[model samples]
Target: MKTLGQKIRERREELDLSLREFAKKLNCSPPFISDVEHGRRFPSEPMLEEMARLLKLDVAEIKRHDQRAPLDEIKRMTEQDPGYAFAFRTLVDKKLTPEQLLELVNRSKPSPKGGKK
Candidate 1:
């Protein structure tokens, strides 16, 4: 699996940008760009957004390249539970964006532990 850095580097190359050129566009040093390409550093959210704009990347594409754990965990849960399986299927059917799902989850109140409240 390619790391986030590799993915960024690939996109940069696809745009035919040299390290110096890309760094200049991003307003960072070449070394910082190199470290980010080599996985020695994580990019900031603002940087990520700039990259997304430059690379024509959407939120889903970026998340897929950077974070797979949430999807993997859901896959595991679906395999172990029929309810989860159904819910996963429903989510796919609805084509809900990750941001929308996150909003829904954030808005929900967690149930009280042990049914005490």
Candidate 2:
């Protein structure tokens, strides 16, 4: 799993941006950008939204990488309910490997007998 800093660095590089240049564009100090890229500091939500715009990444991608569930808690959850774990793992694996599920989800429409639209 890539860290938020790693993702930020990668995106910055992909855009051919120097740290100073990126910082200038973000209207923040270079040291702040450095801290964020080195994982010494986390960006605020508004800062993250700015990064998403400048880097052309979805805000959710940055947020997800930045905030992660602790591994120990995840392990405990899986241990407490193996069936839930299995189902979750299966869904994630399918999500990664196939487009069918994604397409189905994206293409889903309101049912004629719907309770909610």
After superposition, which runs of candidate 2 have C-alpha atoms over 4 Å from their true positions? 68-117
Instruction: Provide the lowest-lDDT 10-residue window in model 1.
Output: 108-117
Model 1 RMSD, rounded to 1 decimal:
8.9
What are the lDDT figures for the candidates, one per model?
A: 0.80, 0.84
Candidate 1 per-residue C-alpha lDDT over 6-116 given as tens digits, one digit per residue, 9 for 90 to 100: 888898899888989989889999999899888778778798788778778785576566642467787788788889888878988999997899887787766676322
Model 2 scores worst on lDDT over the 10 consecutive residues at 96-105
Backbone Cα, N, C clashes tallied per candidate? 0, 0
Model 2, residue 50: distance off in Å is: 0.2
TM-scores vs. true structure, each candidate: 0.55, 0.58
Best by lDDT: 2
Task: Tell me how far candidate 2 lies from the true structure as C-alpha RMSD in angstroms.
Answer: 6.2
